[model samples]
Target: MSFPCSDQSIRPRKMQSASLPGVMEAVRCWCGDVCKVKEVTDFSDWLGMKFFMCANYESDPPESISTYVRPPSPPPLCMYYRWIDTEMPDWAVTEIRERGRRAWASLDLEERREKAEAEEKAEQKK
Candidate 1:
């Protein structure tokens, strides 16, 4: 019943900031340089973070920082990191290793025994 034309020039209003999802920020060591990265939460949960081992480090293990400098205006170091939307502000190399250890520990003697027994039974069935 209203007029056919509304203010066509004006754009629709956006939601208030109160409805925005949380933001994520962290420092990551990629290639050789450390940089900051940003992401948005509420989209997905972060599983874990992992650092990449630079391929160059194998053959040209830099004697010093200068030795690892980017070449001829080369792009920043090629380091890569796996980041997820989660709280891992204190994650370090050692922390990651500890996770691996704990995961292995979770499969202790009892679990191993059960697995072995199951395998033996399956073999008998065959």
Candidate 2:
């Protein structure tokens, strides 16, 4: 409907809610560790659904929020299929790289274990 906060001066008609059934869902950002699921009523421009984003961005909004544009009613921004597509922090990126390296090391250890198992099997056959 016509939200008082929306730029109603331009469009006199109340904007219809998009067709998608929107819902509250957990969202995580690159800069923060907490993943919070807020209600649509919590936002002003929320038509129905929208993508998750850092609300603290430079753009000043009438309402205080921590995410980007909320979606209209019809096409709900299905958060279940969404991901934390953000610019990762340098430390977090490094941490992920380290974890990947550790994973590779674990794989190498498994290879060695397999080789030892093969050697033992051959010895038993001899």
Candidate 3:
């Protein structure tokens, strides 16, 4: 599916609702912040695939106050990267670095809390 947006860079597409193994439920950064989902428009090979990237991925560093001063360096990347359109085997754990693993653990706790709340609400209605 396509969305009506002024930005010509992004081309959106419909994705399946079902969760895929090895695919994150919610894309997140190594710093435990959520990542943004982006669509590829320029790369012909990557077109139609949904990718996750750090929220600050494309941001530029702030400008210097003085003409002679150099701008401060950009913040370090969280290294949160993933492809939402593909699935991988469970053994793919080996591919995740320590930071990614920590982020995933945090994500797991969040998911568990959400599930428990949903179940509790369901039980209340019965």
Clashing pairs for model 1 are 30-79, 31-78, 31-79
- If ranked by TM-score, best first, what sequence of candidates would result? 3, 2, 1
Candidate 1: tens digits of C-alpha lDDT, residues 8-114: 22211211111112353333344444333322222122223222222332223244657448554444344333323235334443566777788788878679999
lDDT of 3 by residue, 1-126 (tens): 222232324433332223333535665566677767764443243444566656655532244456468556655555445666553323333334554788999999999999999999999999
TM-score for each of the candidates: 0.22, 0.35, 0.36
Ranking by lDDT: 3, 2, 1
Candidate scoring better on TM-score of 2 and 3 = 3
Where does model 1 exceed 4 Å of error?
1-90, 113-126
lDDT of each: 0.38, 0.39, 0.53
lDDT of 3: 0.53
Query: Distance (Å) between predicted and true CA of 101, model 2?
Result: 1.1
lDDT of 2 by residue, 1-126 (tens): 111122323221222222222454444444453333222222123322323323332222345553456543343222121212224335545666787899999999999999999999999999
- Predicted structure with the largest TM-score when compared to the true one: 3
Model 1, C-alpha of 54: deviation from truth (Å)? 26
